[model samples]
Target chain A: MKQRERLIEALLALSAGISVLTTGGIIVMLAVEAAHFFRQVPLGTFLTDTQWTPLFADKHFGILPLVSGTLLTTGVAIAVALPLGLIIAIYLNEYATVGFRNVIKPLLEVLAAVPTVVYGFFALTVVTPFLQRLIPGMAGFNALSAGSVMGIMILPLVSSLSEDALTAVPRSLREASYALGATRLQTAMRVVVPAASSGITVSVILAISRAVGETMIVAIAAGQEPRLTANPLVPVETITTYIVQVSSGDVAYGTLEYDTIFAAGITLFVLTLVLNNVGYWFRQKFREQYE
Target chain B: MSNMTRNRLLDGAFRAVGLLATLLGLLLLAVFLLDILRTGLSRLSWQFLSALPSRFPERAGIYTALLGTVWIMVLTALIAVPVGLAAGVYLEEYGRKSRWSALLEINITNLAGVPSVIYGLLGLNIFVRFLRMGSSVLAASCTLALLILPILIVATREAIRAVPKTLREASFALGATRWQTIWYQVLPASMGAFLRELFWPCRGRWAKRPRCSCWGCWPTCRLRQKAPWTSFRRCPFKYSTGFRAPSRHSESTPPPLLLCCCSLRLG
Candidate 1:
């Protein structure tokens, strides 16, 4: 019995070690490649240059355009998702009758479960065409439609997480507000929402990280032009889309073009790491304070 | 405006807006499904399933991608399940709380949110490039196994944590050893719940992808473009959430299930 116990413990510890090892591997892989890329292009030029014409004969490797492109899509996504998601979450938690709530719950799951690629396909083939007719000078492959669909895609993330947060607020607080003659909307908006503020902020930030990392929608719909403009109607390329483009075609090992992607990957990895960890921090803070 | 009449009007307006907010999401989903079904259903015949992929969409099939997905899923499950279980049991039951254990806990949580495409990049570097697996089924399987491990570990830990502590003490009183108690009592009790939890995120990985990324969606799509919506059915966890939640609620927290069952039934 003693021998058997030791073996089981060893196996469990071994798997736990593997998890740690994988995390180390991710950091090391991205770091080493990115370091090599920076050797080819100076950090100053990469960060400060305005033009991102890497594939052209006059190759200027400015990362600003890509950064701007990413911000454009994510900016539009946050604009759409932040309001819609918060409102829906409020409606789901504070307003709906049980029967109405039940119907909406599965609909939320259905909306959430639709594949990102399916969203990409729909955005590219259906929505883009429709938008072109409605909005003048809206490029067939533009950031606006892609970002709009991505907003819809991450709607559940924001709404569901916010709902979870709102739901976590103790009933006593709501009762206390009601006893003070507060209306339901007033109680939810002023009392419960303020109480769940940290959690709601975390959800919104996590949604931002998700948008930053999203690839397929931007890859399929957003045109491959690495442009500096923030205009929604024009075509733009994002960091993830650039990675997809590079990986799809062979940039032979150890080349400058190959190195650029790892550099971009590092940037994306860092940005999302900061955002996601901040969200995780807020969640931890909220739980520690409340639970 | 009279306070009573104005209050009633505002309440009615709020209800209408809430219902509309809910309906808009449903309308978009309805259109997406309708479009996919209309475009892809005629191509989902047995011939499409059985025939090899071809250059022309008319003559194309999903056999290769289907087989690839099945093969990868089995391999990933085989690799991930045992490792996840062992890590969960160790972390939850055995590992004492310390700085090290706390770091591991936080790492696992963060790993759960790392993008799937990043995992694909890691797979490209580690399995296909360094290991020289050459983008084969085995490399993809390993990539997916790593991708899903954190999710499974989290689920297993949650399930084990959900199991009542009193049950373990009873087993100890009955003179059962730790291994025997876990194997005989805990495993039997939590296995159904654990399996359901473990399966959902694995399905989520493939849910967003029909043609697995390690395999590349473009090559297969170029070979056969017809079966766009074929992936919808294979992912069971989406709809199964509604069915699975209420049952598990009763098992874990019988008292709360009375209150939780209604909300759990839909989502």
Candidate 2:
């Protein structure tokens, strides 16, 4: 029995170490590859170059275009998602009857489960055309459609998470508001929403990070022209899409083009990592304060 | 307008906006599903399920992708379940709230947020290049196992946490060892919820990338050789358009959950 217990403990410890191992591997691999790339291209040039024509004859390695694309798409996505998601959460939590909440909640789950690639297809075939018809300047394949679909893709993430946050507010708070004769809307918007703001902020930040890291939707629908512009109506290439593009090509390992893939991945990783850490900090703060 | 009337009107308008937001999300989903079904449901005959992918769109099928998905899900489960459950068990039961464990907790949570494509990238580096596994089924499965690890570990911890403390106390009082107590008592009690949490998120991932073949490398190989018009027509359609059943399945789960919660509350 003693021997068996020791063996089990060893196995459990090894299992726990695997995640730590994976993170270590990613950091080391990305660092080595980034170091190799920076040896060829200066870090200043990579960051400040306005043109992102890496594969072109001139081979300008400016990442401004990629960053712009990611930002534009993320900005568009958040604009659509945050308000809609917050309202959906408020509706489910405060106004809806139990029956209504049950139905709407599952619908949101299904909405959340719908694949990004499908949204890619929807943007490509359905949303883009519909938008072009409605707005004269809308490109057939533009960031607007992709961003809109991504918004829909992330809608449930924001709503469900924000709803969880809202639900965690003490019931006594709601009862107190009611005893003071506040309307349901007043209680939800002023009392409950303020109480859940930290969680809501975390959700929004997480969603923004997810949007920045999104690939397939942008790859398939958002046009691949790397342009250093902030316009959502135009084609743009994001860091993620750039990675996907390079990976699909036969860029030999260890080549400058190949190393750029790692550089792009590193940037995307760092961007999301910052957002995630901030979101994680807020989540921890909220959990501790509430509990 | 009178003060009370104006206040009531504002409340009604906000309520309308909330209801509209809920309906908008549902409406978009309904349209997405209807669009997929209209285009792809008719293509789901037995021949579509049985035939190999062909050059012609009319003849191509999802036979490879379907089998590949099954292979991935099964293989990923084989690798992920034991490790994830053990990690969760160790963290919750054996491990204490030390600095190391706290660091581990943050690492796991951060890993959970890393993009799936980054996992794809890492899989390419480690499993394919360093380990020389290539982009075969094993490599992709390993990547997916790593991808699902955070979810599985977190879920297992939550499930184990939910198991009443009294159950473990009873087993210990009976002179059962810790391993024996977990295996016989806590494990059995939490299996259903744990499985749901583990598999549901993985299913969500699969739903996210239904088009990815046994390993992602295979599909990329096929695409690199040619324009891949047939793949554009088939793989995405098969994976994304084929989710109607699961949506219906998700719909069935909540009603019963509501029923149980109501019963418990009443009792």
Candidate 3:
């Protein structure tokens, strides 16, 4: 009996350890491949160079264009998601009836659950045309439409997280605000919002991280032109998009060109890791205060 | 009285904006569904369902793609569920408050946040190249299994944690081993919550198409070469480029594109 118990424990522990192995694998694979890439192209050029055209004969290996593209789209997505998500969260937590909140919350989550490829198609076919009419100079494949659709894709994530935060705020705080003759909006905006600020901040940061990592929508809608421009009206290629562009083609394995994806992948991995850790730190601090 | 009226108006205005904000998600969903239905509803005939994808847009159907998706789904579930469940059980039932366990917990959370495309990179490197799986369905399924493992582990932990402490204690007093206690008492008790939590990962894996593309599981490639007859080794690909193709073949592509949307809704 003791031996069987020990055997089962070992098996279960091995299964649990797979997650650790996965992380190690990601780190090692990216590092090894990226080391190969850096040996070919200097790290300074990878960092400081403005252009990111490796496939072309000119062969610039700068990562700035991809980084800028990522920043711009992520900025646009956050701009759209932060306010809208907060508003929706405020409405659901403070104003809506329980039944309405219950129904609408799940429906909103369906927005997130929809395949991003579908959103990419929507951005390309539906949104770009609409934006073109509204903004005459808008390119067929521009950051604005893709970023907007991605914002909508990420909205549920923000709203749901923010809503949980709002719900966590003590009831006494709201009642106290009401006793001070505060209106519903004033109570929601001032009392609950302030109290839940940390959670909301965590959500926004996490959403930004998600937006930064978003691939399909940007790949399909935002043209694969790696220009160092912040203009939402023009085409740009994000890091993920660049990775996709390389991977989908028949690039021979172990080549410097193929190694660029890993280099790019590590850059992406680091960026999101920082953001996630920040969010984690914020949540830990917030939990200490509340719990 | 005038100040009160002004505040009331501001409150009402904010309320209106908030309501509109809430409705925005529903509004977009409505538009997407309506557009897909309007364009693709007519093309849902049996021929469209059964025919192989052809160069001629009129003859293209989602038969191979659908079969591929089902294959991927089953395989991914087969791999992910057991491992995820075991991991969750270990964390909740067996893990003591040690530094190692804490590190493990944080690692899982971080893994969950790593982008799906990065997982694609990992899949391409480890599964496709290292293991020589050659972009087959097994490689894609293994990749997705890893992708969704964190989510499943978290869900399983939550479900197992929700199982009352008393149940475990009772099982222990009855002279059951820890494994038996977990398997018979805790797992059965937590089954409902566990199943509910399982739905999201299932839906997510079903909807996950981009990773397939990353694995080089293009539908055209899969269709040209007959996949191995064995269930485990089949080449399943999601038709991600179908949306892009319609731009050139506008006349014949909308139906299949719309069909994908409809099927997505059903899934």
Highest TM-score model number: 3
Q: What does the lDDT read for residue A242 in candidate 2? A: 82
All candidates: interface RMSD: 8.7, 7.8, 5.3
Candidate 2 per-residue lDDT over residues A61-115, each given as its tens digit:
8888999999999888998999999999998899889898877775666655544
Cα misplacement distance, residue B259 of candidate 3 (Å): 8.4
lDDT of 3 by residue, A1-291 (tens): 999999999999999999999999999999999999999999999999998989889899999999999998899888888899999999999889999998887777766666676677778888999999999988998999999999988888788888877988988889999999999999998899999998888888888888888888888899899989979999999998888878877788889898999899999999999998988888788752645
lDDT of 2 at B158: 77
Candidate structures ordered by TM-score, highest first: 3, 2, 1
What C-alpha lDDT does candidate 3 achieve relative to the native structure? Answer: 0.78
Q: For model 1, what is the alpha-carbon lDDT of residue A170?
A: 89
Compare candidates 1 and 2 on TM-score and give the better one. Answer: 2
Between candidates 2 and 3, which one is better according to DockQ? 3
Tens digits of per-residue lDDT for model 3 on B1-267?
Answer: 698898899999988999998888689878876765665566566776677767766776666665666677678889999999999998888887978778889998898788888888888888777997766677777888888788778778878878889999999999999989988999999988887665532222211111112221121211111233323222122334555565433334344344345334433
Per-residue alpha-carbon lDDT of candidate 2 for residues B1-267, written as tens digits (9 for 90 to 100): 887677678789988999999999999978877766655555456776666665454565556655655565577879988999999998888887878788788888778767776777888888877887765667766887888787778878878888999999999999999999999999999998776554342222211221111222112211211121112222332333232233332212122222222222321
DockQ for model 1 equals: 0.19
**Model 2 regions lying over 4 Å from their true place:** A286-291, B199-267
Name the top DockQ candidate: 3
Q: Is candidate 2 or candidate 3 better by TM-score?
A: 3
